[model samples]
Target chain A: MQVTRRQLLQAGLLATAGLVIPALGRTADNSKENLLLSSVTDKDDKNWWVLSDSQGNILAQHLLPGRGHGSARHPSGKSAVIVGRRPATFMSVVEVSPQGEYKFTDLTSATGRHFFGHAVYSVDGKFIYTTENDFDNGRGVIVVRDISNDYKVIAEWESGGIGPHELRMMPDGHTLVIANGGILTRPDQPREKLNLDTMKPNLAYLDTRTGEMLSKHELPDHQLSIRHIDVADTGRVWIGCQYEGMALDPMPLVYHHDLNQGGLQAAEASMDTWRALKHYTGSVVADNQQGIIGISSPRGDRVTFWDNQSGKHLQDIKLRDVCGLIPSPNGKQFVATTGKGDIAIIDAQTLAVTSESRTPELHWDNHLQVLA
Target chain B: MRNCLLILILLCSTFSHAAEREPEAYLKMLNQALKLIQPAHQLFADQAEELHNQIGQLCQSPSEDSLQTTRNQWRKTMESWMKVSVIQFGPLLENDSRLRIQAWPIRARLLTMGIKQLETAEAPPTLEQIAQGTVAVQGLPALEALLFRTDALSGLQQGQACAAAQTIAEHLIVLANTLNQRWQNEFGRDFADPVNTPGGFDTPQEAFDEYMNGLVTAVQQIKRRKLEDPLGLAGKPGKAGATESYLSENSRDNLHNNLTALILYLTGGEGYGVDDDLIAQDPDSIAVLVLDDRIKGITKYNKQLTMPLEALVKPATPEAEAQREVAESIFKELSLLNKAFENQIFEALGVTRDFNSEDGD
Candidate 1:
């Protein structure tokens, strides 16, 4: 890695940030560092997609006109496409160079539809598949964009449920798995669930190349709205749920289903812990190397770990208002963020905090998209 | 060196001023716990203790006068419990103490089973045994059944039921004292993290989030569970006993107290008033003030529901329909308040909703 004059100046300004903070200028020399990407809000309450180095040093920040949710890092390792918060119309394709220079191109959802705040870039870096709403039709959709040609909308398909949220590509690289959270919301009435009486949340799988629906699974209890998800190297989908039923009812918040197994397996936990969760699980990620999964519950104020194969409750580490969770680039640890801007790196084996960092001023939002 | 560099980066890139506003809010939270929540719990404990003594005297020599006095004290104690119940976020949640005191959406099976055991058992339940008893007989609802139910109260007036009633009150007093102690000694300190290190709160934003989340959840619970559920506003047939405090018929007053606190807390009357600051921070502060007004409006509407919630929900008369209208108003206001909470409060505090928080979902 070459350190140019530009790099030295950038580091100086970053280190000697006076009361009047300077804009973080990108260095001309490319430095190979593991950068972590996530959506953030600044002191003025504006939203941004921020990139931080492996040690949690701020690198680059790109402002979004609206709030952002989950982001999709392109396979080419060159850029990321971050979608705006739901009922969201904007998606910003952010370019991150090895030299720490960050740029972005903004795109809008089709009329009468919007990004559900999650998308997946093609493994070959040719296209982007975004979860969207066909709001007028009362169905969800998957819109394919040709990345080479300005993210042009090339194709569309039903998302197989009402409100499709987080989606990821399967290990096969062509099969896209989606969590279709079956709550209807129109732009006019943003974030309002119109159909709790008849919500039909499901875990859906589709072939990315053809938009062909291969499989879809719904919870037996319809009130458990399937939302955020993470797919492992082995294609096991760990799903999280937010229950719309009675608050105190005991409901399973974590589930896993292997694509080949064709059956959804519920993670087993004591009724006490499940009750403590209050029918809410925020983010779900699989620590593939450690053979475990971690789920966060901001409502319960705890992050719980579960064994991947046995679906057994492994451990619970408590934190207030914590949500964003990402397994480390190595898969040997997990980095978790909260609504209060606290970050903790947990040892995957012991489920213990290795180190904790706090950004008392900024609230780290939902998903942390790790970039290598 | 690594820690130093980390601290330098955190200090340089992050804005510390945003954290400064937190102490005011943090102090406000401590004020609420001390001024409102602690005193409310203490009053409930005192009332429960007084009720126990009254029940003891009544049972020692049963009379219409003595028993009526005991029944009246029971009503006072139950209402006092409801006032303290709104502090549902912290220590009250520990050991399922809240449920132990008064489990609502009340279940009759536990009451029936506990009642039969209390009346027919060879030995009257010791406090330890009653403490160990299923949650059903351990709370105010059991007292409601024992006092209001004919066969059950007969056992109590006959001196067969004095011990269980006495035990429940003693247990409630013990819980109240523990709650006050925990809030004072530990949980309240934990709630108001003055320095962010050892304080359960890592930062002021966290303390704010916890406080707002608890308050919003309480308001929603009152609007949906306490009022709308019994009113059958969601189109289900409302049941009579399903209303909170159904036996005592004070669910409306419970709503009033809840709405008052919700309004008071948000308006900066109690402490950590986010509304005034929210309004001042943005030209669009009207939205937040309007939300506060809506919350206050809930208290007014609560007063208009002169009929018991159980009665209002059971019959479809004009008066019942009017009460349902009040319920709907409260529901809509609470819904807007919830949204304002996520949007206004989040913006004022410079925070974002964590992934998949029920707010955005």
Candidate 2:
């Protein structure tokens, strides 16, 4: 008999409650037990925030009113929050109880603002910071929410640029690094970029405690929209950029900024390698343990790896529409998800696919998260 | 649940069949497309050279006959470009060839500023200078403003304006020849054997997907940029000024050529083409039927328009109103054509519609 998603989720809940249902055919691999979370559009055209084991088994899910983009897992591993895609008006928080039950709370965007599809939890998990577009004012803002007070908005700070995207906290736990994309857009126009010629993208380091801008770095070319980022434990930040200029213009799509170095430097790659990326980098992730950085270009249908220490190109693996990437729990491998419904684990040292599975029913979105 | 299982089984069968189809079939289609495309590029180059020569003649000795001949040659060159613009891959995508040949939705303000600078310059800009300038003033749209805009005839009769037009015409010849040479040489060979050649596709399916994507994007450009934006069918008041080829009054002809080129691409000029592949997958495929009917419907409505697109969009009289109606009908048919490709053709052919191209962060 075929198992339904509802039944599988129920089995997961029961297992979490210390009751095993052997008839449900749970795989016997407790060593690889972390749950991967992603926003997906299913075959039936429904949006969902899903949690699945490394083997691609759906464990829990919550239907979303709209498409979701990035997700953040709470430090305690008991909850995760998913933000709707850009020009977003809703965010969903899903909490899993020890009894295997799921509680979902939906939050609306603050007035005159829209979520930029990414958010981060504080090191203590007491607050959540989200990037938003203050459309009427033509500025990007960071909204701080008190996770303990029912996710209430407590403060807002300037993001120091126009179209700020992904943000991450530095290892110091007091600084927030933001990728200001620099393309001016309004809620009325939605995805239509209003400014490209005069846009100035920057990498900003902000003191989260006082809402002060610490330092900001900008690229010489104004059209490179720095969109996504990943920070290693050692405080090296990797950024992925999407170029808004002509397609024929050869521009590097990945860059790194070291807190100690104090400048934005392009990742060293041959011009041929840069051309193959099709001028778009959807996601950037780093494995500090192995000193490797991986940047994915869904437009180019490949994921390229680089030496984190030297910023030199290493190798690329071809995977159609592969975007979401994260370091595995052990930091010895990388877990990747694609829009084609593929989940793959690549050995960090050899860059070999250790395991892969395809669901065909779920089209994973841009970002992925792992529940600790 | 039972119905879902049945659907899954059917999809798996279709997918396996698509995978098992010989790569030779797709290669044959690619070769056939090249056959049509190579000569189209050659013709465009030939026409550009002729336009260049005619402009030089008119500039050397200004007259109504010479100017008219030069304008006529420009029209021929533009028509030739429309035929091959559907092939947006390979050499056309390399080195800014497409933009250098014909950058459209022309930045009118920038073009005017560039022209003014050219008019006051001490010497006429050379071909290299034109090539090095901004894309807005380097190609056919710029030439159109120089040769067809108000007072253009007087402007081009022995001054810096005529010299600027001449240099731009020369630049077009160089751009067109480079595109044709690259397409005929290495890129052509690599494209033919996509699975084996370096810098080529990884699979025959990928090559086929590229071809289909080119065709689909062309149709979408025609519908959205050519029609909807100018006609205000996309939820704003119609702007006659936004119509492409407004100065030349050739917008309707450009649309007609675009549709003709799309149909030719689908049929592969009477050879094995996408249409054949669709029928081979399933004889009663709805995608093929919709595609054929919509093309015919669009062609019929386009042919019924008695006025240019700019005038039809403004609709000043009863006759213009009828023409506007015909234009709207064409937009509807183009919409249906785009839908068929997006919904059915990609799935039936086992081609994955690119996610990032459609929606990306």
Candidate 3:
């Protein structure tokens, strides 16, 4: 086959990325036990919050009140909530009974505030903390909802930055770590980042009980918009960044921080690999089983895994329209979903794709929440 | 044509077997794209080359008859362009090539400045230089202005504007030839068998997605931009100037060519309609049949239209009402096609137009 100059250049870049990220070593976890949850866009332009087994079989699905984004589940695993995507004014809270019956409720955000498409239930399952855009103030805030009292907005707390996205409780169970994305945007423009030059993204730790600011760690580069995150049991916060800088300027995409150590460490991938990541990561999964951090880039159509200890790129899997990622219930595998409807589980250690399925006629959106 | 009738019968009878016939349907799509759609682009290049030659002939001897013949040639070339216009990816996507060929609405200020500069400059810009100039006087739209202007023949007789017209024509041929050559020899051939190449496009499914999406968006443009906007569905009446090709009064033909090319892609050109093959074994071939009728409806309306699209919105004549009816029908047909793809063809085939422009934040 003849190789044109453009083709050769592309091959060179991929080959360079391959040098640091190894071909996935094969290992299989025959587990189909974990239930995965996601917001899906179906063929008929309808949106649904969907739950499936690790094998991607639909277990339960419900029509969302509106278009949805990342979901939050109560620690008990019996209930979950789907937050409407940015600028959407609603949230759906759903509970699945042991008998498989479902109960649902709709909660509205306060005036001038909109859910930023992600919410996390308190570890005790009492309150759900959602990342929201305080559009009037152009700041990110965590809106606390009392699940016991009809999921009402009980309290609000500053996220310590402008655009707080995905947040998770610390391993200690008392502190919540937030990825305050630092970019400012309004509901009118929706996802447009109004402030970039002065944007200050940080990984912030807050006292869950008092809403007191604990510590905030910012990356060396201001242009890197720290957004999505997943927490390991060891308290290392793995972050995925969406760059708000120039498209041509290459920047680090994956990061991890030890709140104890007090600094953000960039997951070291080759420049070629980082470029292939397209300066965007839609989601991140931290596997406790093997300390693997999985980050998905939908634009690049790639899921890259890295070692948490060394911050080294372990392996990279090529997928078309890949975005969602989560560690399976067993933590031994990562269930990855794509906008093209692929649901594949990669073994955390070997990075081998153990099983795969395609949900015909469905487009899985940016985040997948798994109950291990 | 006989084969089409046979396929139509086959499609209607066993429509529920889409799952079983899905692979064959996709393969046929690949084959038809390579065979029928690829040639449409080559024909566009060939016609563009002819137009360049005709413009040169008109410049050599300015006459009313020759100018009229040249205008006819322009219409034919544009129709050819619309026929192959759905191939928006691969070779056609490079270097502002598509926009250079046809920038709509004509940026009046830049065009006036460009023409003024051309007239006043002692050394007029050459074909290559004009190719590098602004889009206003760069391609077909520029040629339209140069030819259709009321003062065209007078300016041609004075040996001014003729060189620029001929130069724009040659530049268009260059772009068209480049696109045609690249598609026919390299990109089109490689894209047909994407799995064979190791650099990217991980699966055969991705190649299918690319082809179908190209056609899908082309159809979308025809419905949303070409027809609705001019017909005052997108805008209020008397705003047909938002219509494409308005200067030459060919917006209806532009739309007709668009739908004609879209139908050509839909059916694979005298072959089984993609919906027919993909939905052949599915229960929803009923939607496909309606879609088929709607396409025929568009063709019928095009045949019956008595005036250009510009008149459809202005003065609100009875014929304008007729045009409005055709526009509404075309809109419904486009919706049916979209639904058929979403519910039956694309779903049964397990492909997703995931990166489609319609997705929200």
Cα lDDT, all candidates: 0.73, 0.80, 0.73
Candidate 1: docking tier: incorrect
Q: Model 2, A305-361: lDDT tens per residue?
A: 999888899999877778888877778778888876777778889997777776654
**RMSD (CA, angstroms), candidate 1:** 8.6
Tens-digit lDDT track for model 3 on A206-274?
Answer: 888999998999998898888889888877888999876633324688988888795898888876687
- Compared with the true structure, the alpha-carbon lDDT of candidate 3 equals 0.73
Winner of 1 and 3 under TM-score: 1
Q: Indicate whether candidate 1 or candidate 2 has the larger TM-score.
A: 2
TM-scores of chain A across the candidates, in order, are 0.90, 0.91, 0.88
What are the C-alpha RMSDs, in order, of all predicted structures? 8.6, 6.7, 12.0
Residue-level lDDT tens digits of model 2 in B186-258:
7766677777777667666667767777777788889988899899896777878778888889898888888
Highest TM-score: which candidate? 2
- lDDT by residue (tens digit), candidate 1, B1-361: 8567645644443433432354565565555545566667678778888987887887788777887787888888877776677665777776667877876665566577777788777777888886665677777877777776665446775534777777777787777778778766666666665454364665565655666666766767886788666777666777777788776677776676677666765665645456656655654443455465666666677667666677677566988778767767877777777666554555555444453354544
| Model 3 pairs whose backbones collide | A329-A372, B15-B281, B15-B282, B16-B281, B16-B282, B17-B281, B18-B281, B267-B273
Root-mean-square deviation of Cα positions for candidate 3 versus the true structure, in angstroms: 12.0
Off by over 4 Å in 1: A1-34, A54-58, B1-36, B46-74, B95-181, B188-248, B259-358
Native-to-model Cα distance after best TM-score fit, residue A257 in candidate 3, in Å:
19
Please identify which of the two predictions, 1 or 2, would achieve the higher lDDT against the true structure.
2
